[model samples]
Target: MSNLEIITESRFTTVFIIKMLYAFMCGAHLDSIINEIRELEKPSKNYKRMKPATKFIKQPLEGLWHKHYEQVGLKSMAMNIKQQMGLNNKQQKIFNNTFFKEFCDIFNNSEIPQDKRIEALGYLCSGKQYIDRINDGKLTGEWIIYHHCNGKNYYLNVGNHSDGDDALAQEIREIALFEFPFFKGSLPIFD
Candidate 1:
Protein backbone atom coordinates (compact mmCIF):
# COMPACT_ATOMS: atom_id res chain seq x y z
CA MET A 1 0.00 0.00 0.00
CA SER A 2 1.06 3.56 -0.67
CA ASN A 3 2.04 6.02 2.08
CA LEU A 4 -1.08 8.14 1.19
CA GLU A 5 -3.30 4.99 1.40
CA ILE A 6 -1.88 4.13 4.85
CA ILE A 7 -2.24 7.78 6.04
CA THR A 8 -5.89 7.94 4.89
CA GLU A 9 -6.87 4.53 6.34
CA SER A 10 -6.23 5.74 9.92
CA ARG A 11 -9.62 7.27 10.98
CA PHE A 12 -9.31 7.67 14.74
CA THR A 13 -8.13 11.19 15.80
CA THR A 14 -5.26 9.96 18.08
CA VAL A 15 -4.23 7.15 15.68
CA PHE A 16 -3.93 9.62 12.70
CA ILE A 17 -1.75 11.97 14.80
CA ILE A 18 0.51 9.07 15.93
CA LYS A 19 0.91 7.79 12.31
CA MET A 20 1.85 11.27 11.01
CA LEU A 21 4.38 11.69 13.84
CA TYR A 22 5.95 8.31 13.01
CA ALA A 23 6.20 9.33 9.29
CA PHE A 24 7.92 12.64 10.23
CA MET A 25 10.37 10.70 12.41
CA CYS A 26 11.37 8.69 9.31
CA GLY A 27 12.73 11.88 7.57
CA ALA A 28 12.94 10.79 3.83
CA HIS A 29 9.50 8.98 3.88
CA LEU A 30 7.94 12.09 5.56
CA ASP A 31 8.82 14.21 2.48
CA SER A 32 6.84 11.83 0.21
CA ILE A 33 3.75 12.05 2.46
CA ILE A 34 3.93 15.86 2.52
CA ASN A 35 4.38 15.90 -1.28
CA GLU A 36 1.36 13.61 -1.72
CA ILE A 37 -0.77 15.95 0.43
CA ARG A 38 0.35 18.93 -1.71
CA GLU A 39 -0.50 17.08 -4.90
CA LEU A 40 -4.02 16.25 -3.64
CA GLU A 41 -4.63 19.92 -2.74
CA LYS A 42 -3.84 21.19 -6.30
CA PRO A 43 -6.66 22.12 -8.71
CA SER A 44 -7.47 19.49 -11.34
CA LYS A 45 -6.34 19.89 -14.99
CA ASN A 46 -9.00 17.33 -16.16
CA TYR A 47 -11.02 18.82 -19.02
CA LYS A 48 -13.78 16.21 -18.42
CA ARG A 49 -14.62 18.16 -15.25
CA MET A 50 -15.15 21.33 -17.33
CA LYS A 51 -18.41 22.22 -19.11
CA PRO A 52 -17.47 24.12 -22.33
CA ALA A 53 -21.13 24.58 -23.32
CA THR A 54 -21.77 26.38 -20.04
CA LYS A 55 -19.30 29.07 -21.18
CA PHE A 56 -21.21 29.59 -24.47
CA ILE A 57 -24.54 29.68 -22.62
CA LYS A 58 -23.27 32.32 -20.19
CA GLN A 59 -21.76 34.52 -22.95
CA PRO A 60 -23.21 38.07 -23.01
CA LEU A 61 -25.60 38.10 -26.00
CA GLU A 62 -27.90 41.06 -25.50
CA GLY A 63 -28.29 44.52 -23.88
CA LEU A 64 -24.75 45.57 -22.89
CA TRP A 65 -23.06 43.59 -25.66
CA HIS A 66 -25.28 45.12 -28.35
CA LYS A 67 -25.06 48.62 -26.93
CA HIS A 68 -21.23 48.37 -26.71
CA TYR A 69 -20.49 46.90 -30.16
CA GLU A 70 -23.16 49.13 -31.71
CA GLN A 71 -21.40 52.17 -30.34
CA VAL A 72 -18.09 50.84 -31.66
CA GLY A 73 -18.38 49.41 -35.26
CA LEU A 74 -19.84 45.86 -35.56
CA LYS A 75 -23.42 47.15 -35.44
CA SER A 76 -22.80 49.39 -38.47
CA MET A 77 -21.23 46.46 -40.34
CA ALA A 78 -24.17 44.21 -39.46
CA MET A 79 -26.60 46.93 -40.59
CA ASN A 80 -24.70 47.36 -43.86
CA ILE A 81 -24.78 43.61 -44.52
CA LYS A 82 -28.46 43.48 -43.60
CA GLN A 83 -29.36 46.32 -45.96
CA GLN A 84 -27.18 44.99 -48.82
CA MET A 85 -28.53 41.42 -48.46
CA GLY A 86 -32.16 42.72 -48.01
CA LEU A 87 -32.67 40.62 -44.85
CA ASN A 88 -36.14 40.69 -43.34
CA ASN A 89 -36.82 40.78 -39.60
CA LYS A 90 -36.84 36.97 -39.34
CA GLN A 91 -33.71 36.57 -41.49
CA GLN A 92 -31.95 39.31 -39.49
CA LYS A 93 -32.77 37.45 -36.26
CA ILE A 94 -31.21 34.24 -37.63
CA PHE A 95 -28.14 36.15 -38.83
CA ASN A 96 -27.71 37.72 -35.39
CA ASN A 97 -27.94 34.37 -33.58
CA THR A 98 -25.47 32.62 -35.88
CA PHE A 99 -22.76 34.83 -37.48
CA PHE A 100 -22.99 37.90 -35.21
CA LYS A 101 -22.84 35.87 -32.01
CA GLU A 102 -19.80 33.97 -33.28
CA PHE A 103 -18.14 37.30 -34.19
CA CYS A 104 -18.76 38.68 -30.69
CA ASP A 105 -17.38 35.50 -29.12
CA ILE A 106 -14.15 36.00 -31.10
CA PHE A 107 -13.78 39.54 -29.72
CA ASN A 108 -14.66 38.45 -26.17
CA ASN A 109 -11.95 35.78 -26.25
CA SER A 110 -9.27 38.39 -26.96
CA GLU A 111 -8.61 42.00 -28.00
CA ILE A 112 -8.51 41.22 -31.74
CA PRO A 113 -7.69 44.07 -34.17
CA GLN A 114 -10.58 45.39 -36.34
CA ASP A 115 -9.03 44.09 -39.60
CA LYS A 116 -8.42 40.67 -38.02
CA ARG A 117 -12.03 40.52 -36.78
CA ILE A 118 -13.35 41.32 -40.29
CA GLU A 119 -11.00 38.71 -41.84
CA ALA A 120 -12.04 36.09 -39.26
CA LEU A 121 -15.77 36.75 -39.79
CA GLY A 122 -15.27 36.59 -43.58
CA TYR A 123 -13.40 33.29 -43.27
CA LEU A 124 -16.02 31.89 -40.87
CA CYS A 125 -18.89 32.77 -43.20
CA SER A 126 -17.03 31.58 -46.34
CA GLY A 127 -18.02 28.36 -48.23
CA LYS A 128 -21.70 28.81 -47.33
CA GLN A 129 -23.87 29.16 -50.48
CA TYR A 130 -26.76 30.89 -48.68
CA ILE A 131 -24.70 34.09 -48.30
CA ASP A 132 -23.58 34.00 -51.96
CA ARG A 133 -26.58 35.80 -53.52
CA ILE A 134 -25.63 37.63 -56.77
CA ASN A 135 -26.82 41.03 -57.98
CA ASP A 136 -26.19 42.71 -61.38
CA GLY A 137 -23.70 39.93 -62.33
CA LYS A 138 -21.54 40.72 -59.28
CA LEU A 139 -21.41 39.50 -55.68
CA THR A 140 -22.99 42.37 -53.69
CA GLY A 141 -21.70 44.04 -50.51
CA GLU A 142 -18.53 43.98 -48.39
CA TRP A 143 -19.65 40.96 -46.38
CA ILE A 144 -19.69 38.22 -49.06
CA ILE A 145 -17.83 37.23 -52.23
CA TYR A 146 -18.47 34.15 -54.37
CA HIS A 147 -15.32 32.75 -55.99
CA HIS A 148 -14.90 29.56 -58.00
CA CYS A 149 -11.86 27.39 -57.22
CA ASN A 150 -11.21 23.80 -58.54
CA GLY A 151 -14.88 23.50 -59.68
CA LYS A 152 -16.00 24.36 -56.11
CA ASN A 153 -17.80 27.57 -54.99
CA TYR A 154 -16.18 29.47 -52.10
CA TYR A 155 -17.19 32.83 -50.62
CA LEU A 156 -14.77 35.34 -49.11
CA ASN A 157 -15.16 38.98 -47.95
CA VAL A 158 -11.45 39.80 -48.14
CA GLY A 159 -8.63 38.70 -50.52
CA ASN A 160 -8.17 39.32 -54.26
CA HIS A 161 -11.45 38.36 -55.95
CA SER A 162 -12.53 39.77 -59.36
CA ASP A 163 -15.13 42.03 -57.73
CA GLY A 164 -12.50 43.55 -55.42
CA ASP A 165 -11.17 46.96 -56.54
CA ASP A 166 -7.73 47.14 -58.19
CA ALA A 167 -6.30 49.01 -55.14
CA LEU A 168 -7.65 46.38 -52.74
CA ALA A 169 -6.28 43.52 -54.91
CA GLN A 170 -2.86 45.20 -55.13
CA GLU A 171 -2.87 45.76 -51.33
CA ILE A 172 -3.65 42.07 -50.75
CA ARG A 173 -0.86 41.05 -53.15
CA GLU A 174 1.66 43.39 -51.50
CA ILE A 175 0.70 42.14 -48.03
CA ALA A 176 1.03 38.50 -49.16
CA LEU A 177 4.48 39.13 -50.77
CA PHE A 178 5.66 41.06 -47.69
CA GLU A 179 4.49 38.30 -45.35
CA PHE A 180 6.01 35.47 -47.48
CA PRO A 181 9.16 36.61 -49.35
CA PHE A 182 9.78 33.14 -50.92
CA PHE A 183 6.52 33.31 -52.99
CA LYS A 184 7.93 34.63 -56.33
CA GLY A 185 4.85 33.79 -58.40
CA SER A 186 1.60 35.79 -58.49
CA LEU A 187 -1.30 34.73 -56.22
CA PRO A 188 -4.16 32.72 -57.72
CA ILE A 189 -6.60 34.97 -59.65
CA PHE A 190 -10.00 34.41 -57.98
CA ASP A 191 -12.21 35.07 -61.02
Candidate 2:
Protein backbone atom coordinates (compact mmCIF):
# COMPACT_ATOMS: atom_id res chain seq x y z
CA MET A 1 0.00 0.00 0.00
CA SER A 2 1.00 3.65 -0.50
CA ASN A 3 2.44 5.86 2.25
CA LEU A 4 -0.63 8.05 2.24
CA GLU A 5 -2.75 4.98 2.80
CA ILE A 6 -0.59 4.04 5.76
CA ILE A 7 -1.01 7.54 7.22
CA THR A 8 -4.76 7.20 6.70
CA GLU A 9 -5.12 3.68 8.05
CA SER A 10 -7.03 3.91 11.34
CA ARG A 11 -4.73 2.18 13.80
CA PHE A 12 -1.36 3.58 12.73
CA THR A 13 -2.83 6.79 11.37
CA THR A 14 -4.37 7.95 14.63
CA VAL A 15 -0.97 8.18 16.24
CA PHE A 16 0.47 10.09 13.30
CA ILE A 17 -2.50 12.41 13.22
CA ILE A 18 -2.27 13.00 16.96
CA LYS A 19 1.43 13.79 16.72
CA MET A 20 0.88 16.24 13.89
CA LEU A 21 -2.07 17.79 15.63
CA TYR A 22 -0.06 18.15 18.80
CA ALA A 23 2.80 19.71 16.89
CA PHE A 24 0.54 22.13 15.10
CA MET A 25 -1.47 23.00 18.16
CA CYS A 26 1.72 23.54 20.14
CA GLY A 27 3.28 25.63 17.35
CA ALA A 28 6.08 23.11 16.99
CA HIS A 29 7.89 21.53 14.07
CA LEU A 30 8.72 17.93 13.23
CA ASP A 31 11.83 18.00 15.41
CA SER A 32 9.82 19.25 18.37
CA ILE A 33 7.18 16.65 17.64
CA ILE A 34 9.87 13.97 17.76
CA ASN A 35 11.16 15.35 21.05
CA GLU A 36 7.67 15.47 22.57
CA ILE A 37 6.88 11.92 21.48
CA ARG A 38 10.16 10.74 22.95
CA GLU A 39 9.28 12.48 26.20
CA LEU A 40 5.83 10.94 26.19
CA GLU A 41 7.26 7.46 25.62
CA LYS A 42 9.71 7.90 28.48
CA PRO A 43 6.88 8.65 30.91
CA SER A 44 5.14 5.37 30.13
CA LYS A 45 7.65 3.29 32.09
CA ASN A 46 6.96 5.29 35.23
CA TYR A 47 3.23 4.82 34.75
CA LYS A 48 3.73 1.06 34.57
CA ARG A 49 4.65 0.84 38.28
CA MET A 50 1.64 2.77 39.51
CA LYS A 51 -1.16 0.67 40.97
CA PRO A 52 -4.53 1.48 39.50
CA ALA A 53 -7.77 1.37 41.48
CA THR A 54 -9.01 -1.53 39.37
CA LYS A 55 -8.44 -3.36 36.07
CA PHE A 56 -10.48 -0.70 34.30
CA ILE A 57 -8.18 2.07 35.52
CA LYS A 58 -5.08 0.03 34.78
CA GLN A 59 -6.32 -0.83 31.31
CA PRO A 60 -6.87 2.80 30.40
CA LEU A 61 -3.44 3.76 31.72
CA GLU A 62 -1.92 0.90 29.74
CA GLY A 63 -3.84 2.04 26.71
CA LEU A 64 -2.53 5.56 27.26
CA TRP A 65 1.01 4.26 27.51
CA HIS A 66 0.51 2.28 24.33
CA LYS A 67 -0.79 5.38 22.63
CA HIS A 68 2.20 7.41 23.80
CA TYR A 69 4.60 4.77 22.48
CA GLU A 70 2.61 4.60 19.30
CA GLN A 71 3.06 8.34 18.85
CA VAL A 72 6.80 7.91 19.31
CA GLY A 73 6.75 5.18 16.68
CA LEU A 74 4.80 7.47 14.44
CA LYS A 75 7.51 10.10 14.80
CA SER A 76 9.93 7.69 13.10
CA MET A 77 7.24 6.87 10.62
CA ALA A 78 6.81 10.61 10.05
CA MET A 79 10.49 10.91 9.23
CA ASN A 80 10.03 8.21 6.63
CA ILE A 81 7.04 10.03 5.27
CA LYS A 82 8.99 13.29 5.16
CA GLN A 83 11.78 11.65 3.17
CA GLN A 84 9.53 9.62 0.88
CA MET A 85 7.22 12.49 0.04
CA GLY A 86 9.98 15.15 -0.23
CA LEU A 87 8.24 16.92 2.64
CA ASN A 88 11.59 17.95 4.09
CA ASN A 89 12.07 20.86 1.71
CA LYS A 90 9.02 21.77 -0.36
CA GLN A 91 6.04 20.66 1.66
CA GLN A 92 7.61 21.54 4.99
CA LYS A 93 8.24 25.08 3.87
CA ILE A 94 4.72 25.47 2.57
CA PHE A 95 3.16 24.09 5.74
CA ASN A 96 5.28 26.26 8.01
CA ASN A 97 4.56 29.41 6.06
CA THR A 98 0.86 28.77 5.90
CA PHE A 99 0.59 27.84 9.56
CA PHE A 100 2.51 30.86 10.86
CA LYS A 101 0.92 33.35 8.56
CA GLU A 102 -2.47 32.15 9.61
CA PHE A 103 -1.49 32.08 13.28
CA CYS A 104 0.03 35.56 13.26
CA ASP A 105 -2.77 37.02 11.22
CA ILE A 106 -5.22 35.68 13.70
CA PHE A 107 -3.33 37.48 16.44
CA ASN A 108 -2.83 40.86 14.69
CA ASN A 109 -6.41 41.37 13.71
CA SER A 110 -8.56 42.83 16.48
CA GLU A 111 -11.55 41.72 14.42
CA ILE A 112 -10.64 38.32 15.80
CA PRO A 113 -12.17 37.63 19.21
CA GLN A 114 -10.32 39.03 22.24
CA ASP A 115 -9.87 35.63 23.87
CA LYS A 116 -8.41 34.02 20.72
CA ARG A 117 -6.18 36.99 19.99
CA ILE A 118 -4.93 36.86 23.54
CA GLU A 119 -4.29 33.15 23.20
CA ALA A 120 -2.36 33.59 19.94
CA LEU A 121 -0.36 36.47 21.34
CA GLY A 122 0.29 34.40 24.43
CA TYR A 123 1.69 31.65 22.24
CA LEU A 124 3.96 34.15 20.54
CA CYS A 125 5.13 35.46 23.92
CA SER A 126 5.27 32.36 26.12
CA GLY A 127 5.87 28.79 24.96
CA LYS A 128 4.89 26.86 28.10
CA GLN A 129 1.54 28.53 28.65
CA TYR A 130 0.95 28.53 24.91
CA ILE A 131 0.99 24.74 24.77
CA ASP A 132 -1.36 24.44 27.73
CA ARG A 133 -3.78 26.97 26.26
CA ILE A 134 -3.72 25.58 22.74
CA ASN A 135 -5.94 22.55 23.32
CA ASP A 136 -8.24 24.27 25.77
CA GLY A 137 -8.62 27.59 23.90
CA LYS A 138 -7.96 29.53 27.08
CA LEU A 139 -6.10 32.84 27.33
CA THR A 140 -3.88 33.81 30.24
CA GLY A 141 -2.79 37.26 28.94
CA GLU A 142 0.12 37.24 31.33
CA TRP A 143 2.93 37.82 28.84
CA ILE A 144 3.57 41.04 26.99
CA ILE A 145 5.50 42.26 23.92
CA TYR A 146 6.84 45.73 23.24
CA HIS A 147 8.57 47.59 20.45
CA HIS A 148 11.27 50.23 20.86
CA CYS A 149 13.49 52.43 18.73
CA ASN A 150 16.69 51.88 20.71
CA GLY A 151 17.98 50.00 23.74
CA LYS A 152 17.55 52.95 26.09
CA ASN A 153 14.24 53.86 24.54
CA TYR A 154 13.01 50.29 24.89
CA TYR A 155 14.03 50.12 28.51
CA LEU A 156 12.70 53.53 29.47
CA ASN A 157 9.50 53.94 27.48
CA VAL A 158 8.25 50.48 26.57
CA GLY A 159 7.86 48.96 30.04
CA ASN A 160 9.68 47.16 32.83
CA HIS A 161 12.60 44.99 31.69
CA SER A 162 12.09 42.63 34.63
CA ASP A 163 9.08 41.11 32.94
CA GLY A 164 11.26 40.10 29.93
CA ASP A 165 14.25 41.52 28.13
CA ASP A 166 15.47 41.72 24.58
CA ALA A 167 17.17 38.37 24.99
CA LEU A 168 13.90 36.75 25.98
CA ALA A 169 12.23 38.59 23.14
CA GLN A 170 14.81 37.17 20.79
CA GLU A 171 14.15 33.68 22.13
CA ILE A 172 10.46 34.07 21.50
CA ARG A 173 11.23 35.18 17.96
CA GLU A 174 13.50 32.18 17.48
CA ILE A 175 10.76 29.83 18.64
CA ALA A 176 8.39 31.54 16.26
CA LEU A 177 10.90 30.98 13.48
CA PHE A 178 11.19 27.32 14.39
CA GLU A 179 7.46 26.98 13.99
CA PHE A 180 7.39 28.93 10.73
CA PRO A 181 10.85 29.47 9.26
CA PHE A 182 9.45 30.00 5.79
CA PHE A 183 7.51 32.96 7.13
CA LYS A 184 10.64 35.09 7.47
CA GLY A 185 9.74 37.16 4.43
CA SER A 186 6.08 37.57 5.28
CA LEU A 187 6.32 38.78 8.87
CA PRO A 188 7.25 42.27 9.92
CA ILE A 189 10.82 42.25 11.21
CA PHE A 190 11.38 44.71 14.07
CA ASP A 191 14.78 45.82 15.17
Candidate 3:
Protein backbone atom coordinates (compact mmCIF):
# COMPACT_ATOMS: atom_id res chain seq x y z
CA MET A 1 0.00 0.00 0.00
CA SER A 2 1.09 3.61 -0.63
CA ASN A 3 2.47 5.50 2.37
CA LEU A 4 -0.51 7.87 2.07
CA GLU A 5 -3.02 4.98 2.39
CA ILE A 6 -4.44 4.51 5.88
CA ILE A 7 -3.52 1.14 7.44
CA THR A 8 -6.04 -0.77 9.59
CA GLU A 9 -4.33 -1.01 12.94
CA SER A 10 -5.06 -0.99 16.68
CA ARG A 11 -6.64 2.19 18.11
CA PHE A 12 -3.39 3.25 19.83
CA THR A 13 -1.21 2.69 16.72
CA THR A 14 0.16 5.59 14.69
CA VAL A 15 -2.35 6.13 11.86
CA PHE A 16 -0.18 8.49 9.80
CA ILE A 17 3.42 7.36 9.97
CA ILE A 18 4.30 9.04 6.67
CA LYS A 19 2.71 12.28 7.83
CA MET A 20 4.55 12.08 11.16
CA LEU A 21 7.90 11.57 9.40
CA TYR A 22 7.19 14.46 7.04
CA ALA A 23 6.25 16.64 9.98
CA PHE A 24 9.41 15.62 11.87
CA MET A 25 11.56 16.46 8.84
CA CYS A 26 9.84 19.85 8.62
CA GLY A 27 10.48 20.47 12.38
CA ALA A 28 6.74 20.40 13.17
CA HIS A 29 5.34 18.77 16.32
CA LEU A 30 3.45 15.39 16.11
CA ASP A 31 0.46 17.10 17.74
CA SER A 32 0.46 19.75 15.00
CA ILE A 33 0.57 17.03 12.32
CA ILE A 34 -2.34 15.24 14.01
CA ASN A 35 -4.32 18.49 14.12
CA GLU A 36 -3.58 19.07 10.41
CA ILE A 37 -4.86 15.56 9.62
CA ARG A 38 -7.95 16.19 11.76
CA GLU A 39 -8.60 19.43 9.92
CA LEU A 40 -8.27 17.65 6.58
CA GLU A 41 -10.71 14.94 7.74
CA LYS A 42 -13.27 17.49 8.90
CA PRO A 43 -16.04 18.24 6.44
CA SER A 44 -16.05 21.64 4.78
CA LYS A 45 -18.52 24.34 5.92
CA ASN A 46 -20.03 24.46 2.43
CA TYR A 47 -20.63 20.68 2.51
CA LYS A 48 -22.20 20.91 5.97
CA ARG A 49 -24.47 23.82 5.06
CA MET A 50 -27.63 22.81 3.21
CA LYS A 51 -30.41 25.08 1.98
CA PRO A 52 -33.92 24.20 3.24
CA ALA A 53 -36.23 22.70 0.60
CA THR A 54 -38.93 25.29 1.24
CA LYS A 55 -38.98 28.85 2.46
CA PHE A 56 -42.62 29.31 1.37
CA ILE A 57 -44.89 30.24 4.27
CA LYS A 58 -48.70 30.35 3.97
CA GLN A 59 -50.39 32.99 6.09
CA PRO A 60 -53.89 31.89 7.22
CA LEU A 61 -56.52 33.97 5.48
CA GLU A 62 -59.50 31.97 6.79
CA GLY A 63 -60.25 34.62 9.39
CA LEU A 64 -59.76 37.32 6.79
CA TRP A 65 -61.96 35.44 4.33
CA HIS A 66 -64.68 35.04 6.94
CA LYS A 67 -64.42 38.66 8.07
CA HIS A 68 -64.43 40.05 4.55
CA TYR A 69 -67.06 37.74 3.05
CA GLU A 70 -69.26 36.47 5.90
CA GLN A 71 -69.45 39.40 8.36
CA VAL A 72 -69.97 42.33 6.01
CA GLY A 73 -71.74 40.53 3.13
CA LEU A 74 -70.12 43.14 0.94
CA LYS A 75 -70.01 42.82 -2.87
CA SER A 76 -66.29 42.16 -3.06
CA MET A 77 -64.64 39.83 -5.53
CA ALA A 78 -64.99 36.82 -3.23
CA MET A 79 -68.59 37.67 -2.48
CA ASN A 80 -69.38 38.08 -6.15
CA ILE A 81 -67.68 34.75 -6.77
CA LYS A 82 -69.54 33.02 -3.92
CA GLN A 83 -72.83 34.34 -5.27
CA GLN A 84 -72.13 33.61 -8.95
CA MET A 85 -70.59 30.17 -8.29
CA GLY A 86 -73.04 29.41 -5.44
CA LEU A 87 -70.21 28.17 -3.25
CA ASN A 88 -71.40 26.85 0.11
CA ASN A 89 -69.29 26.85 3.26
CA LYS A 90 -67.95 23.36 2.50
CA GLN A 91 -67.07 24.22 -1.09
CA GLN A 92 -65.33 27.42 0.00
CA LYS A 93 -63.30 25.49 2.58
CA ILE A 94 -62.28 22.91 0.00
CA PHE A 95 -61.23 25.66 -2.44
CA ASN A 96 -59.15 27.42 0.20
CA ASN A 97 -57.51 24.16 1.35
CA THR A 98 -56.69 22.94 -2.15
CA PHE A 99 -55.39 26.33 -3.27
CA PHE A 100 -53.24 26.61 -0.17
CA LYS A 101 -51.85 23.10 -0.70
CA GLU A 102 -51.01 23.83 -4.33
CA PHE A 103 -49.36 27.10 -3.27
CA CYS A 104 -47.29 25.26 -0.69
CA ASP A 105 -46.26 22.63 -3.22
CA ILE A 106 -44.94 25.31 -5.58
CA PHE A 107 -43.38 27.60 -2.99
CA ASN A 108 -41.80 24.86 -0.88
CA ASN A 109 -40.07 23.51 -3.94
CA SER A 110 -36.44 24.70 -3.55
CA GLU A 111 -36.00 24.55 -7.30
CA ILE A 112 -38.19 27.67 -7.70
CA PRO A 113 -36.68 30.94 -6.51
CA GLN A 114 -38.36 33.23 -3.98
CA ASP A 115 -39.16 35.86 -6.61
CA LYS A 116 -40.67 33.31 -9.05
CA ARG A 117 -42.90 31.38 -6.58
CA ILE A 118 -45.79 33.82 -7.02
CA GLU A 119 -45.51 33.64 -10.81
CA ALA A 120 -45.50 29.85 -10.67
CA LEU A 121 -48.53 29.88 -8.35
CA GLY A 122 -50.30 32.29 -10.74
CA TYR A 123 -49.68 29.91 -13.62
CA LEU A 124 -51.00 26.91 -11.68
CA CYS A 125 -54.06 28.66 -10.26
CA SER A 126 -55.04 30.11 -13.62
CA GLY A 127 -54.65 26.85 -15.57
CA LYS A 128 -55.22 24.01 -13.11
CA GLN A 129 -58.49 22.97 -11.41
CA TYR A 130 -57.45 22.10 -7.89
CA ILE A 131 -60.92 21.19 -6.47
CA ASP A 132 -62.58 20.38 -9.79
CA ARG A 133 -64.64 17.44 -8.46
CA ILE A 134 -66.41 19.63 -5.87
CA ASN A 135 -66.50 23.11 -7.40
CA ASP A 136 -67.67 22.18 -10.93
CA GLY A 137 -64.52 23.50 -12.61
CA LYS A 138 -64.21 26.47 -10.25
CA LEU A 139 -60.59 27.25 -11.12
CA THR A 140 -61.54 27.48 -14.77
CA GLY A 141 -62.69 31.04 -14.13
CA GLU A 142 -60.83 31.81 -10.90
CA TRP A 143 -58.97 35.02 -10.15
CA ILE A 144 -56.72 35.17 -7.11
CA ILE A 145 -55.21 38.55 -6.25
CA TYR A 146 -52.10 38.20 -4.15
CA HIS A 147 -49.43 40.50 -2.76
CA HIS A 148 -45.95 39.15 -2.16
CA CYS A 149 -44.53 41.03 0.79
CA ASN A 150 -41.29 40.15 2.55
CA GLY A 151 -41.36 36.54 1.28
CA LYS A 152 -44.93 36.06 2.54
CA ASN A 153 -47.80 35.57 0.06
CA TYR A 154 -50.96 37.41 1.02
CA TYR A 155 -53.94 36.31 -1.04
CA LEU A 156 -56.10 39.41 -1.08
CA ASN A 157 -59.07 38.32 -3.14
CA VAL A 158 -60.64 35.39 -4.96
CA GLY A 159 -62.80 36.22 -7.98
CA ASN A 160 -64.21 34.23 -10.86
CA HIS A 161 -65.96 34.46 -14.22
CA SER A 162 -68.99 35.83 -12.40
CA ASP A 163 -66.93 38.87 -11.35
CA GLY A 164 -65.84 39.58 -14.95
CA ASP A 165 -62.34 38.53 -16.00
CA ASP A 166 -61.35 42.02 -17.23
CA ALA A 167 -62.40 43.58 -13.93
CA LEU A 168 -60.39 40.98 -12.02
CA ALA A 169 -57.37 41.47 -14.26
CA GLN A 170 -57.64 45.24 -13.89
CA GLU A 171 -58.01 44.88 -10.12
CA ILE A 172 -54.76 42.89 -9.98
CA ARG A 173 -52.96 45.53 -12.07
CA GLU A 174 -54.27 48.39 -9.94
CA ILE A 175 -53.28 46.62 -6.74
CA ALA A 176 -49.81 45.89 -8.10
CA LEU A 177 -49.42 49.41 -9.49
CA PHE A 178 -50.92 51.42 -6.63
CA GLU A 179 -50.76 49.22 -3.52
CA PHE A 180 -47.61 47.14 -3.93
CA PRO A 181 -45.91 49.44 -6.39
CA PHE A 182 -42.50 48.22 -5.28
CA PHE A 183 -43.36 44.59 -6.08
CA LYS A 184 -40.66 42.64 -7.91
CA GLY A 185 -42.38 40.00 -10.03
CA SER A 186 -43.96 41.28 -13.24
CA LEU A 187 -47.77 41.14 -13.33
CA PRO A 188 -48.72 37.57 -14.31
CA ILE A 189 -51.18 37.52 -17.21
CA PHE A 190 -54.17 35.27 -16.41
CA ASP A 191 -55.44 35.21 -20.02
Using all chains and alpha carbons, the TM-scores for the candidates as numbered come to: 0.21, 0.21, 0.24
lDDT of 3 by residue, 1-191 (tens): 53123311111112124323543564444443333223233434442111111221323221111001111122332433444334588877876877788889998999888779888876555434322322432212222334434544434334433655455445444444443445434334321
How do these models rank on TM-score, best leading?
Answer: 3, 1, 2
In candidate 1, which residue pairs get closer than 3 Å at backbone N, Cα or C atoms, i.e. clash?
Answer: none
Name the better of 2 and 3 by TM-score. 3
CA lDDT of 145 in candidate 2?
A: 23
Minimal lDDT window, size 10, model 2: 151-160
Candidate-wise lDDT, in order = 0.34, 0.35, 0.38
Against the true structure, candidate 1 reaches a TM-score of 0.21
lDDT of 1 by residue, 1-191 (tens): 65544533321123333434543453323443333233333424541211111101121111100000011134434543445345678977886677667867876666788788777767656523223322221222121112222332221112112333444334334443343343333224311
Per residue, candidate 2 scores C-alpha lDDT tens digits across 1-191 of 74323322222223334435544454434443333233332334433311111111231111111111111244434433333323357766885676577667877798988997888766544453233333332321111122222221011011112434444344434443444344344324321
Of candidate 3, the 10-residue stretch with the lowest lDDT total is 62-71
Candidates in order: C-alpha RMSD to true structure? 27.3, 24.8, 28.4
Candidate 3 local lDDT, residue 128: 41
* lDDT ranking of the models: 3, 2, 1
